[model samples]
Target: MPITTEKEQLVAELSDKLTRTKGAVLTTYSGLSVAQDTKLRRKLREAEVEYRVVKNTLTRIAAAKANITGLDKHLEGTTAIAISYTDPVAPAKVLSEFVKELKGKNLEIKAGIVEGKVIDANGVKSLASLPSREVLLAQLLAGMQSPIVGLVNVLHGTTRNLVCALEAIRKQKESA
Candidate 1:
């Protein structure tokens, strides 16, 4: 079948997004109310993530063009994608939280991609469980600094001990 111009445009656009996005989560948004969808979109927007309902056929073609594999099976059934260009964890984090809030009223996670690697739903959950990039960086910095801090304290203690010993000797000499 010949592809229509509009579909070609959609494929091009989705292809671009898939290639450029740092991370993306595929979800099943069936049974979601308008209000709930709006709330989810707001939260995603605040996190700087883009959420859109996608045509599975167009997305499959786009994903192929983007060199992304292992996404075909998960594209079925009321698909929407949450894409993040900056923070890899933002989409998963927001969607997971939103799902929790809904109490399983159909906003189910399907799969996700992070840094070009495709991951399953469980993997998405684990990704969501991770701290934000900033927090992880802070933790790493603290880990890197702890040894230096400990070494400094040890050096200071050694100098203080030497000074105390010297003072003790001086006091003994004065008394003698």
Candidate 2:
């Protein structure tokens, strides 16, 4: 079958998005009101995630073009993709929080891809449970500094004790 220019454009655009995204969450947004959808979009936008309803077939083509596999099964249903280029956890975290806020009313998470690896819904939730990248990095830095800080304190204490002993000897000699 000859491909239409419009479809080719769509495929190209989606392929580019898929290729560039660090993470993407597939969701079923059926039965959501316009207000709810807008709110969701706004939240996702603030998190620097792109949320858009996607045609399943076109997305499948795009996924193939982007060399992403294992996305076909989750592509069914009322599909919208939340993609983030900067933070792999942003989409999952934002979507999970939004669904929790809605009390799981209209939006249902299907699956997700992180760093090019396809993960299940539970995996997506686990990813969302993690702290943000900055927080994790901070924690790691603190962890790395802990031993050094302890060592410095130990050295300082030893030097202080030696100085105190020397002062006591000097005082004894003067008294004698």
Collision count for each candidate, in order: 0, 0
Model 1, residue pairs in steric clash: none
Work out the TM-score per prediction.
0.93, 0.95
Quote the lDDT for 124 in model 1. Answer: 96
| Model 1 lDDT tens row, 9-105 | 9999999998999999999998988899999999999999999999999999999999999999898889999999998899999999999999867
Stretches > 4 Å off in candidate 1? none
In the range 41-87, model 2's lDDT, one tens digit per residue, is: 99999999999999999999999999899999998889999999999
Q: Name the candidate that leads on TM-score.
A: 2
RMSD of each: 1.4, 1.2
